[model samples]
Target: MTGSLQGETVLVVGRGSGIARAIVGAAAAEGAQVVAAGRNREALESAYKGTSVSVKGVDLTDEASIAALADDVGSVHHVVSTASARARGALGELSPEAILLSFHTKVVGPIMLAKHFAPEMPRTGSLVFFSGVAALEPDPGFLGVAATNGSVNVVIRSLAVELAPLRVNAISPGTVDTGAWDGLGEKKGAFLEKLSAANPARRLGTPEDIAQAVVFAMTNTFMTGVSLAVDGGQPLV
Candidate 1:
């Protein structure tokens, strides 16, 4: 790590595992004071125990919770949100509630975080949100997921323009072995193998892959309103 974020404070909003956990570790490795926040404050605290990361509670679906978190965290140099509610199912199996939850958690939540946290961040500060390859390479049984991620890819552009000197970007990941596919159960290994073969890189992604891209986005002042695809060229094929 170049310690590009040395002395800077980074706030990462998400659960205490998978990509979110990896992001926290990555930011800390870059010499930033990282805060791991989510709805489960206790879990975060426990997960990050014995580490430098601090834990806080914030519900993405609720504005009041976000505002309260902003008040608690006060000033921050960079903020990264990795929270997402995936509605994985075909059109017929999808419910209105699931779609709405996906949109609210992945799309609307990051926007609100920017709104409240922007006031406290400096001009050089950046905001990184999580998008996914589902948006770029649409697939069946993930319509809601695609729509939610697609919205994020667009919103960051508007946010960058509106926020000006404050950088806004997103990290779009492909099939990362962050245990997200664990729900696939017995088929998880075969599914990953198939994806790896199809991907141009001939491999599935990892949480560290996405986290490294996020660090780049946050530190590169020239980059904004862009969605960095750290999908190992999965979208290429």
Candidate 2:
């Protein structure tokens, strides 16, 4: 609304849908030059077709890929990483590979991003990452998810201090209707309904809701090294 991002470049790393797409839209609406990058470059190109958005390829698990992306994009005003590998299972069901993938994708990957991109960013530039309510509201089946998110929370603080003036923060989302639960099949609706009623906000979160918070994190000059919770109060109850 403020068009504060006009003429600025924003690079968002994630799949071309869900919260990532919403963020691209939000930033673009604020007059930013948005680049959407993920493993599926063709899909992203198609997704943003006819728009001002550009598309690129990236794999969070690969540090080289991240570095190359940083080179390709050059200087940017802000960067948002929404990529995550979900390892949803109980202790017995969780595998070492799955856990490693989760950490590699969410934790180590972003670190690599900062390593390569920070040099190209202005002092006013910022980085936004995705943490989750799982870190705060630990549950049985989401152990891996929680651990990865918890690491992100700590990383945000460390990076904020280390990167100083280059703002680093995260957005922790509660239960959202992002089709992440569609794998639940018929049970998905009921699952969301239960969470909606339980959440203090009395509704499931939307990509746009999280996007609005991200805009704040990117534009707010003084805020850094913090994880913003945009989960509609799901962790409280």
Cα RMSD for predicted model 1: 0.8
The runs of at least 3 residues in candidate 1 whose Cα sits more than 4 Å from the true structure, single-residue gaps closed, are: none
User: Clashes per prediction?
Assistant: 0, 0
lDDT per model, in order?
A: 0.93, 0.93
What clash pairs does model 1 have? none
Q: Worst 10-residue stretch by lDDT in candidate 1?
A: 203-212
Candidate 2 per-residue lDDT over residues 58-79, each given as its tens digit = 9989989998999888999998
Clashing pairs in 2: none
Q: What TM-score against the true fold does each predicted structure earn?
A: 0.98, 0.98
Positional deviation of 10 in candidate 2, in angstroms?
0.4
- Expressed as tens digits, the lDDT of each residue in 18-120 for candidate 1 is 8899889999999999988999889998999999898899999999999999999999999999999999999999999999999899889999999999988
**Stretches of candidate 2 exceeding 4 Å from the true structure:** none
The deviation in Å at residue 34 for candidate 1 is 0.7
